[model samples]
Target: MDKYPYTPGHRGIETSIAAAIDINPKLGRLQRVSEAAIRDAGTQGLTADELAAKLGQDRCSIQPRTSELKRLGIIIDSGLRRSNWTGKSAIVWIIAPMLNSGESPSQ
Candidate 1:
């Protein structure tokens, strides 16, 4: 007789950790807003104000969300630099890919 073990759902510990990270209930809302902004950006990308407007959130909320997303490796910050407009620095951000095929889903 061969024995087989049952595997849990697609995500186990990761899901738990993500839930735990949301110590503040608003964190989830912020994350969703960030995700929506990223989705709206698509290949074009967006600035902080653009993201905030797209998500219907204030810059204060969007900034923290962007920081958290960057911490989670979901987004990359290109740092602030001069834009086409004078006296204005543009902070570019890029959304990272969810996963790499060769990389395992679990840590």
Candidate 2:
């Protein structure tokens, strides 16, 4: 079993969370900003690139924040995908509804 509460083979979330804990204050702020951006986006959902653009930051910089938010159960994958800046499909994310907020990873 994986020791962390993250998907097997996925290091980005784990790494981001770890780095946020010790390396950067900006990342933690970005997570909060990203959360609001995603929530304000409504059902349309924003991809990492879109959020980055809106936040006046680099896409790569904000992508990890999204991953961390997802891991924390604060946001969720919306079962939809949209074209990113590179024209490749990217998963759309939305804030987890209030009812789902209390649910744990196992639920």
Candidate 3:
């Protein structure tokens, strides 16, 4: 990832992240990590920056995966937003509706 300073509520930042993930599908690990965190986060949901903090990663690292996971139908917006590192409100993500069981269906 290029070293770009994150500007709160900037459209460019999001666009760049999307572009990177689109180009590199090897970011699968991040997707799994993000999904697990979002599920573990439970109904309260967590913003990208909050998930990053919980995982001890950079916001850029967590944000892109969340975007990808949302696209993959693994997660969804909780219809909530909260302050991020820049003190700007950001959407919180929860696990997708189908994954609510906590345990896999086979378990």
Candidate number of the best TM-score: 2
Output the better candidate (1/2) by TM-score: 2
Candidate 2: segments with Cα more than 4 A from true spot: 1-23, 99-107
Counted clashes in each candidate structure: 0, 0, 0
Task: Itemize residue pairs with steric clashes in candidate 2.
Answer: none
For candidate 3, write residues 55-78 as lDDT tens digits. Answer: 888886678777667765678899
The numbered model that scores best in lDDT is 2
- So what's the TM-score on candidate 2? 0.71
Q: Which stretches of candidate 3 lie over 4 Å from their true place?
A: 1-26, 101-107
Give the range of the ten consecutive residues with the poorest summed lDDT in model 1. 1-10
Ranking by TM-score: 2, 3, 1
lDDT of 2 by residue, 41-87 (tens): 98898999889999999886788777777877888899999999889
**Global CA lDDT computed for model 1:** 0.57
lDDT of each: 0.57, 0.75, 0.73
lDDT of 2 at 22: 55
